[model samples]
Target: TKRYYHERVLDHYNNPRNIGSFDKKAIDVGTATVGAPACGDVMKIQIKVKDNIVVDVCFKTFGCGSAIASSSLATEWVKGKTLDECLEIKNTDIAKHLSLPPVKMHCSMLAEQAIKRAIYDYKVKHEKLNNSETTTIETIASL
Candidate 1:
Protein backbone atom coordinates (compact mmCIF):
# COMPACT_ATOMS: atom_id res chain seq x y z
CA THR A 1 0.00 0.00 0.00
CA LYS A 2 1.43 3.36 -1.06
CA ARG A 3 1.19 6.10 1.51
CA TYR A 4 0.39 9.74 0.82
CA TYR A 5 3.79 10.85 2.08
CA HIS A 6 5.50 8.40 -0.23
CA GLU A 7 3.61 9.90 -3.14
CA ARG A 8 4.82 13.32 -2.21
CA VAL A 9 8.39 12.11 -2.04
CA LEU A 10 8.06 10.58 -5.48
CA ASP A 11 6.78 13.85 -6.84
CA HIS A 12 9.98 15.62 -5.90
CA TYR A 13 12.15 12.75 -7.06
CA ASN A 14 10.48 12.49 -10.44
CA ASN A 15 10.74 16.17 -11.23
CA PRO A 16 13.30 18.05 -9.21
CA ARG A 17 13.75 21.63 -10.41
CA ASN A 18 16.81 23.79 -9.87
CA ILE A 19 18.68 20.51 -9.80
CA GLY A 20 22.07 21.57 -11.12
CA SER A 21 25.01 23.72 -10.11
CA PHE A 22 25.25 27.39 -10.96
CA ASP A 23 28.42 28.91 -12.35
CA LYS A 24 30.79 30.49 -9.85
CA LYS A 25 30.16 33.90 -11.42
CA ALA A 26 26.40 33.36 -11.25
CA ILE A 27 26.58 32.60 -7.54
CA ASP A 28 27.17 35.94 -5.92
CA VAL A 29 26.35 34.94 -2.36
CA GLY A 30 27.82 31.48 -1.66
CA THR A 31 28.10 27.79 -2.44
CA ALA A 32 29.02 24.46 -0.82
CA THR A 33 29.56 20.95 -2.17
CA VAL A 34 30.02 17.90 -0.03
CA GLY A 35 29.94 14.14 -0.40
CA ALA A 36 29.75 10.96 1.65
CA PRO A 37 31.33 8.10 -0.17
CA ALA A 38 30.30 5.58 2.40
CA CYS A 39 26.70 6.44 1.71
CA GLY A 40 27.15 7.21 -1.97
CA ASP A 41 25.68 10.68 -1.56
CA VAL A 42 26.78 14.06 -2.82
CA MET A 43 25.26 17.49 -2.33
CA LYS A 44 25.96 20.81 -4.00
CA ILE A 45 24.22 24.06 -3.09
CA GLN A 46 24.59 27.62 -4.38
CA ILE A 47 22.89 30.91 -3.64
CA LYS A 48 22.51 34.04 -5.75
CA VAL A 49 22.34 37.33 -3.92
CA LYS A 50 20.62 40.60 -4.83
CA ASP A 51 20.32 43.50 -2.41
CA ASN A 52 21.71 41.21 0.32
CA ILE A 53 18.81 38.81 -0.06
CA VAL A 54 18.95 35.34 -1.55
CA VAL A 55 17.15 35.80 -4.84
CA ASP A 56 17.85 32.35 -6.23
CA VAL A 57 19.20 28.94 -5.29
CA CYS A 58 20.23 25.73 -7.02
CA PHE A 59 21.28 22.30 -5.86
CA LYS A 60 22.51 18.95 -7.11
CA THR A 61 22.13 15.96 -4.84
CA PHE A 62 22.84 12.26 -5.36
CA GLY A 63 21.16 10.08 -2.82
CA CYS A 64 17.87 8.60 -1.73
CA GLY A 65 14.48 10.17 -2.26
CA SER A 66 14.51 11.72 1.19
CA ALA A 67 17.84 13.35 0.60
CA ILE A 68 16.73 14.78 -2.73
CA ALA A 69 13.49 16.06 -1.27
CA SER A 70 15.26 17.70 1.65
CA SER A 71 17.72 19.45 -0.62
CA SER A 72 15.01 20.55 -3.02
CA LEU A 73 12.81 21.96 -0.26
CA ALA A 74 15.75 23.68 1.37
CA THR A 75 16.68 25.51 -1.81
CA GLU A 76 13.13 26.72 -2.26
CA TRP A 77 12.94 27.94 1.32
CA VAL A 78 16.24 29.80 1.17
CA LYS A 79 15.32 31.85 -1.87
CA GLY A 80 14.03 35.38 -1.11
CA LYS A 81 15.61 35.16 2.35
CA THR A 82 18.43 37.18 3.83
CA LEU A 83 21.52 35.50 5.23
CA ASP A 84 20.11 35.81 8.70
CA GLU A 85 16.85 34.39 7.51
CA CYS A 86 18.66 31.47 5.95
CA LEU A 87 20.28 30.72 9.27
CA GLU A 88 16.85 30.45 10.84
CA ILE A 89 15.96 27.46 8.65
CA LYS A 90 16.12 24.14 10.47
CA ASN A 91 16.24 20.46 9.64
CA THR A 92 13.00 19.90 11.48
CA ASP A 93 11.23 22.25 9.12
CA ILE A 94 12.40 20.35 6.08
CA ALA A 95 11.47 17.00 7.52
CA LYS A 96 8.09 18.32 8.53
CA HIS A 97 7.43 19.61 5.07
CA LEU A 98 8.03 16.24 3.50
CA SER A 99 6.70 14.10 6.32
CA LEU A 100 9.94 12.24 6.18
CA PRO A 101 10.18 8.86 7.82
CA PRO A 102 12.10 8.74 11.08
CA VAL A 103 14.80 6.53 9.64
CA LYS A 104 15.51 9.10 6.96
CA MET A 105 15.31 12.17 9.19
CA HIS A 106 19.06 12.65 9.04
CA CYS A 107 18.79 13.70 5.40
CA SER A 108 17.18 16.95 6.46
CA MET A 109 19.97 17.56 8.93
CA LEU A 110 22.50 17.25 6.15
CA ALA A 111 20.56 19.73 4.04
CA GLU A 112 20.44 22.21 6.91
CA GLN A 113 24.15 21.88 7.46
CA ALA A 114 24.81 22.48 3.77
CA ILE A 115 22.83 25.72 3.90
CA LYS A 116 24.75 26.91 6.95
CA ARG A 117 28.06 26.11 5.32
CA ALA A 118 27.11 28.14 2.25
CA ILE A 119 26.05 31.10 4.34
CA TYR A 120 29.28 30.95 6.31
CA ASP A 121 31.27 30.91 3.11
CA TYR A 122 29.46 34.05 1.94
CA LYS A 123 30.14 35.87 5.21
CA VAL A 124 33.82 34.95 5.14
CA LYS A 125 34.27 36.16 1.59
CA HIS A 126 32.39 39.38 2.24
CA GLU A 127 34.44 40.15 5.35
CA LYS A 128 37.70 39.51 3.51
CA LEU A 129 36.73 41.95 0.78
CA ASN A 130 35.71 44.60 3.28
CA ASN A 131 38.90 44.16 5.26
CA SER A 132 41.08 44.45 2.17
CA GLU A 133 39.32 47.64 1.14
CA THR A 134 39.71 49.04 4.67
CA THR A 135 43.42 48.22 4.71
CA THR A 136 43.93 49.97 1.37
CA ILE A 137 42.12 53.07 2.68
CA GLU A 138 44.29 53.14 5.79
CA THR A 139 47.52 52.84 3.80
CA ILE A 140 46.45 55.65 1.48
CA ALA A 141 45.55 57.84 4.45
CA SER A 142 48.97 57.26 6.06
CA LEU A 143 50.86 58.34 2.90
Candidate 2:
Protein backbone atom coordinates (compact mmCIF):
# COMPACT_ATOMS: atom_id res chain seq x y z
CA THR A 1 0.00 0.00 0.00
CA LYS A 2 1.19 3.45 -0.79
CA ARG A 3 1.25 6.01 1.98
CA TYR A 4 -0.64 9.19 1.32
CA TYR A 5 -0.95 12.54 3.06
CA HIS A 6 -3.60 15.19 2.79
CA GLU A 7 -2.67 18.24 0.72
CA ARG A 8 -2.94 20.48 3.75
CA VAL A 9 -0.63 18.27 5.75
CA LEU A 10 1.92 18.22 2.97
CA ASP A 11 1.70 21.94 2.56
CA HIS A 12 2.25 22.53 6.26
CA TYR A 13 5.15 20.09 6.43
CA ASN A 14 6.79 21.47 3.30
CA ASN A 15 6.42 25.07 4.41
CA PRO A 16 5.95 25.20 8.13
CA ARG A 17 4.71 28.44 9.65
CA ASN A 18 5.82 30.05 12.91
CA ILE A 19 8.71 27.70 13.49
CA GLY A 20 10.80 29.48 16.10
CA SER A 21 10.98 30.68 19.68
CA PHE A 22 10.13 33.95 21.37
CA ASP A 23 12.01 35.69 24.14
CA LYS A 24 11.47 33.66 27.29
CA LYS A 25 11.87 36.76 29.43
CA ALA A 26 8.86 38.47 27.95
CA ILE A 27 5.96 38.67 30.39
CA ASP A 28 3.42 38.30 27.62
CA VAL A 29 5.01 35.08 26.32
CA GLY A 30 4.33 31.57 27.50
CA THR A 31 6.12 28.41 26.44
CA ALA A 32 5.59 24.70 26.85
CA THR A 33 7.68 21.71 25.86
CA VAL A 34 6.09 18.30 25.82
CA GLY A 35 7.04 14.83 24.63
CA ALA A 36 5.05 11.77 23.72
CA PRO A 37 6.88 8.92 25.33
CA ALA A 38 5.11 6.33 23.21
CA CYS A 39 6.40 7.85 19.98
CA GLY A 40 9.43 9.71 21.20
CA ASP A 41 7.96 12.86 19.70
CA VAL A 42 8.79 16.18 21.30
CA MET A 43 7.15 19.52 20.59
CA LYS A 44 7.56 23.03 21.92
CA ILE A 45 4.91 25.72 21.56
CA GLN A 46 5.15 29.37 22.45
CA ILE A 47 2.34 31.87 22.58
CA LYS A 48 2.35 35.64 22.99
CA VAL A 49 -0.87 36.71 24.62
CA LYS A 50 -2.03 40.30 24.89
CA ASP A 51 -5.23 41.21 26.70
CA ASN A 52 -6.21 37.54 26.95
CA ILE A 53 -5.82 37.03 23.23
CA VAL A 54 -3.21 34.99 21.48
CA VAL A 55 -1.55 37.61 19.34
CA ASP A 56 1.24 35.37 18.11
CA VAL A 57 2.36 31.78 18.24
CA CYS A 58 5.33 29.63 17.21
CA PHE A 59 6.38 26.03 17.46
CA LYS A 60 9.29 23.64 17.08
CA THR A 61 8.84 19.90 16.68
CA PHE A 62 11.38 17.12 16.91
CA GLY A 63 9.37 14.30 15.48
CA CYS A 64 7.81 12.84 12.40
CA GLY A 65 6.21 14.67 9.49
CA SER A 66 2.79 14.36 11.09
CA ALA A 67 3.99 15.93 14.32
CA ILE A 68 5.64 18.84 12.54
CA ALA A 69 2.63 19.40 10.35
CA SER A 70 0.23 19.27 13.26
CA SER A 71 2.22 21.74 15.33
CA SER A 72 2.65 24.09 12.39
CA LEU A 73 -1.04 24.09 11.69
CA ALA A 74 -1.82 24.58 15.38
CA THR A 75 0.34 27.67 15.63
CA GLU A 76 -1.38 29.21 12.65
CA TRP A 77 -4.83 28.51 14.05
CA VAL A 78 -4.14 29.83 17.53
CA LYS A 79 -2.74 33.16 16.48
CA GLY A 80 -5.19 36.03 16.80
CA LYS A 81 -7.56 33.87 18.86
CA THR A 82 -8.62 34.44 22.41
CA LEU A 83 -7.43 31.91 24.96
CA ASP A 84 -10.97 30.62 25.32
CA GLU A 85 -11.13 30.07 21.58
CA CYS A 86 -7.82 28.32 21.54
CA LEU A 87 -8.89 26.02 24.34
CA GLU A 88 -11.78 24.95 22.17
CA ILE A 89 -9.41 23.55 19.56
CA LYS A 90 -9.60 19.78 19.82
CA ASN A 91 -7.23 17.07 18.70
CA THR A 92 -10.01 15.40 16.78
CA ASP A 93 -10.56 18.59 14.83
CA ILE A 94 -6.90 18.74 13.90
CA ALA A 95 -6.74 15.09 12.95
CA LYS A 96 -9.82 15.42 10.80
CA HIS A 97 -8.52 18.55 9.16
CA LEU A 98 -5.21 16.88 8.33
CA SER A 99 -6.83 13.62 7.29
CA LEU A 100 -4.32 11.94 9.49
CA PRO A 101 -4.21 8.18 9.67
CA PRO A 102 -5.31 6.54 12.89
CA VAL A 103 -1.71 5.76 13.73
CA LYS A 104 -0.85 9.44 13.40
CA MET A 105 -3.69 10.65 15.62
CA HIS A 106 -1.31 10.98 18.54
CA CYS A 107 0.52 13.73 16.72
CA SER A 108 -2.56 15.90 16.78
CA MET A 109 -3.07 15.13 20.44
CA LEU A 110 0.46 16.23 21.19
CA ALA A 111 -0.12 19.45 19.34
CA GLU A 112 -3.23 20.14 21.37
CA GLN A 113 -1.42 19.41 24.60
CA ALA A 114 1.33 21.85 23.66
CA ILE A 115 -1.16 24.64 23.21
CA LYS A 116 -2.97 23.88 26.47
CA ARG A 117 0.26 23.63 28.41
CA ALA A 118 1.45 26.98 27.12
CA ILE A 119 -1.81 28.62 28.04
CA TYR A 120 -1.74 27.07 31.49
CA ASP A 121 1.77 28.34 32.04
CA TYR A 122 0.71 31.82 31.06
CA LYS A 123 -2.18 31.73 33.49
CA VAL A 124 0.01 30.53 36.32
CA LYS A 125 2.47 33.35 35.78
CA HIS A 126 -0.24 35.96 35.73
CA GLU A 127 -1.79 34.54 38.86
CA LYS A 128 1.53 34.88 40.67
CA LEU A 129 1.79 38.51 39.63
CA ASN A 130 -1.73 39.23 40.80
CA ASN A 131 -1.12 37.58 44.13
CA SER A 132 2.04 39.59 44.67
CA GLU A 133 0.24 42.79 43.88
CA THR A 134 -2.48 41.98 46.39
CA THR A 135 0.11 41.18 49.01
CA THR A 136 1.89 44.48 48.45
CA ILE A 137 -1.39 46.39 48.78
CA GLU A 138 -2.16 44.65 52.02
CA THR A 139 1.29 45.42 53.40
CA ILE A 140 0.95 49.11 52.51
CA ALA A 141 -2.45 49.27 54.19
CA SER A 142 -0.99 47.72 57.34
CA LEU A 143 1.86 50.26 57.38
Candidate 3:
Protein backbone atom coordinates (compact mmCIF):
# COMPACT_ATOMS: atom_id res chain seq x y z
CA THR A 1 0.00 0.00 0.00
CA LYS A 2 1.20 3.47 -0.81
CA ARG A 3 1.44 6.10 1.87
CA TYR A 4 -0.69 9.18 1.27
CA TYR A 5 1.13 12.29 0.18
CA HIS A 6 -1.73 14.54 1.07
CA GLU A 7 0.47 16.62 3.31
CA ARG A 8 2.86 17.33 0.48
CA VAL A 9 0.10 18.57 -1.71
CA LEU A 10 -1.53 20.44 1.11
CA ASP A 11 1.65 22.27 1.89
CA HIS A 12 1.71 23.73 -1.56
CA TYR A 13 -2.02 24.22 -1.81
CA ASN A 14 -2.21 26.09 1.43
CA ASN A 15 0.86 28.20 0.94
CA PRO A 16 0.76 28.84 -2.74
CA ARG A 17 2.94 31.80 -3.63
CA ASN A 18 2.73 34.12 -6.57
CA ILE A 19 -1.03 33.91 -6.37
CA GLY A 20 -2.70 36.98 -7.81
CA SER A 21 -4.15 38.59 -10.89
CA PHE A 22 -1.94 40.28 -13.46
CA ASP A 23 -2.48 43.34 -15.59
CA LYS A 24 -3.31 42.26 -19.12
CA LYS A 25 -1.60 45.27 -20.66
CA ALA A 26 1.70 44.40 -18.95
CA ILE A 27 1.54 40.67 -19.49
CA ASP A 28 3.35 39.22 -22.45
CA VAL A 29 0.97 36.26 -22.46
CA GLY A 30 -2.38 35.58 -20.82
CA THR A 31 -4.80 32.66 -20.98
CA ALA A 32 -7.88 31.64 -19.04
CA THR A 33 -10.40 28.87 -19.74
CA VAL A 34 -12.11 25.87 -18.25
CA GLY A 35 -10.77 22.41 -18.75
CA ALA A 36 -12.77 19.32 -19.73
CA PRO A 37 -15.59 18.44 -17.36
CA ALA A 38 -14.75 14.78 -17.71
CA CYS A 39 -11.38 15.49 -16.12
CA GLY A 40 -13.03 17.35 -13.27
CA ASP A 41 -10.43 20.09 -13.15
CA VAL A 42 -9.91 23.67 -14.29
CA MET A 43 -6.89 25.96 -14.17
CA LYS A 44 -5.93 29.43 -15.29
CA ILE A 45 -2.23 30.18 -15.70
CA GLN A 46 -0.80 33.55 -16.63
CA ILE A 47 2.79 34.49 -17.26
CA LYS A 48 4.24 37.94 -17.55
CA VAL A 49 7.36 38.15 -19.67
CA LYS A 50 10.07 40.72 -20.00
CA ASP A 51 12.95 40.22 -22.42
CA ASN A 52 11.72 36.76 -23.38
CA ILE A 53 11.81 35.58 -19.75
CA VAL A 54 8.88 34.91 -17.49
CA VAL A 55 9.13 37.47 -14.74
CA ASP A 56 6.01 36.34 -12.95
CA VAL A 57 3.31 33.66 -12.97
CA CYS A 58 0.07 33.01 -11.15
CA PHE A 59 -2.61 30.34 -11.27
CA LYS A 60 -6.05 29.61 -9.98
CA THR A 61 -6.91 25.93 -9.88
CA PHE A 62 -10.03 23.98 -9.02
CA GLY A 63 -9.87 20.28 -8.45
CA CYS A 64 -8.11 17.73 -6.28
CA GLY A 65 -5.34 18.65 -3.87
CA SER A 66 -2.82 17.32 -6.33
CA ALA A 67 -4.16 19.64 -9.00
CA ILE A 68 -3.73 22.60 -6.72
CA ALA A 69 -0.27 21.50 -5.75
CA SER A 70 0.69 21.07 -9.36
CA SER A 71 -0.50 24.55 -10.15
CA SER A 72 1.43 25.94 -7.24
CA LEU A 73 4.56 24.12 -8.28
CA ALA A 74 4.11 25.10 -11.88
CA THR A 75 3.88 28.73 -10.93
CA GLU A 76 7.17 28.49 -9.07
CA TRP A 77 8.81 26.70 -11.95
CA VAL A 78 7.76 29.14 -14.62
CA LYS A 79 8.64 32.38 -12.94
CA GLY A 80 12.07 33.72 -13.78
CA LYS A 81 12.44 31.26 -16.65
CA THR A 82 12.68 31.96 -20.33
CA LEU A 83 9.61 31.04 -22.34
CA ASP A 84 11.52 28.12 -23.79
CA GLU A 85 12.37 26.80 -20.33
CA CYS A 86 8.85 27.25 -19.02
CA LEU A 87 7.59 25.22 -21.94
CA GLU A 88 9.78 22.36 -20.80
CA ILE A 89 8.11 21.96 -17.40
CA LYS A 90 6.38 18.59 -17.49
CA ASN A 91 3.57 16.85 -15.61
CA THR A 92 6.01 14.30 -14.36
CA ASP A 93 8.03 17.05 -12.79
CA ILE A 94 5.08 18.30 -10.81
CA ALA A 95 4.03 14.80 -9.81
CA LYS A 96 7.50 14.04 -8.63
CA HIS A 97 7.59 17.15 -6.53
CA LEU A 98 4.35 16.25 -4.80
CA SER A 99 4.89 12.50 -4.72
CA LEU A 100 1.47 12.04 -6.25
CA PRO A 101 -0.10 8.64 -6.69
CA PRO A 102 -0.55 7.11 -10.11
CA VAL A 103 -4.30 7.55 -10.05
CA LYS A 104 -3.81 11.24 -9.37
CA MET A 105 -1.34 11.62 -12.21
CA HIS A 106 -3.95 13.05 -14.53
CA CYS A 107 -4.30 16.02 -12.26
CA SER A 108 -0.73 16.96 -12.97
CA MET A 109 -1.34 16.49 -16.68
CA LEU A 110 -4.22 18.93 -16.55
CA ALA A 111 -2.05 21.47 -14.80
CA GLU A 112 0.80 20.98 -17.25
CA GLN A 113 -1.39 21.26 -20.32
CA ALA A 114 -3.14 24.31 -18.96
CA ILE A 115 0.16 26.09 -18.43
CA LYS A 116 1.31 25.25 -21.96
CA ARG A 117 -1.93 26.48 -23.42
CA ALA A 118 -1.57 29.80 -21.62
CA ILE A 119 1.95 30.19 -22.93
CA TYR A 120 0.79 29.27 -26.41
CA ASP A 121 -1.93 31.88 -26.30
CA TYR A 122 0.61 34.50 -25.27
CA LYS A 123 3.05 33.47 -28.01
CA VAL A 124 0.30 33.67 -30.64
CA LYS A 125 -0.59 37.21 -29.65
CA HIS A 126 3.05 38.26 -29.50
CA GLU A 127 3.67 36.91 -32.99
CA LYS A 128 0.58 38.58 -34.36
CA LEU A 129 1.74 41.97 -33.14
CA ASN A 130 5.19 41.45 -34.62
CA ASN A 131 3.76 40.20 -37.90
CA SER A 132 1.35 43.08 -38.17
CA GLU A 133 4.16 45.58 -37.83
CA THR A 134 6.32 43.71 -40.34
CA THR A 135 3.48 43.61 -42.84
CA THR A 136 2.85 47.32 -42.47
CA ILE A 137 6.51 48.11 -43.09
CA GLU A 138 6.66 45.83 -46.14
CA THR A 139 3.58 47.42 -47.62
CA ILE A 140 5.00 50.90 -47.18
CA ALA A 141 8.32 49.85 -48.75
CA SER A 142 6.53 48.52 -51.82
CA LEU A 143 4.74 51.82 -52.35
Q: Taking the tens digit of each residue's C-alpha lDDT, what string does model 2 give over 1-143?
A: 56588888989999999999998668899888888899898999999999999999999999988999999999989999998799789889999999999999999988988887788678767874467545643442332
**TM-score of each model, paired residue for residue:** 0.79, 0.86, 0.79
Question: Model 3, range 12-64, lDDT digits (tens) per residue?
Answer: 87898677767655547566444646676887778887788887788888777
Instruction: Rank the models by TM-score, top first.
Output: 2, 1, 3
TM-score of 2: 0.86
Which residue pairs in candidate 3 collide?
none
Clashes of 2: 0
Model 1 TM-score (2 dp) = 0.79
RMSD vs true structure, all candidates: 8.7, 8.5, 8.3
C-alpha positional error of residue 20 in candidate 2 after TM-score superposition, expressed in Å: 0.5
Q: Please give the CA lDDT of all the candidate structures.
A: 0.76, 0.86, 0.74
lDDT: which candidate is best?
2
Worst 10 residues of 1 by lDDT: 134-143
TM-score of 3: 0.79
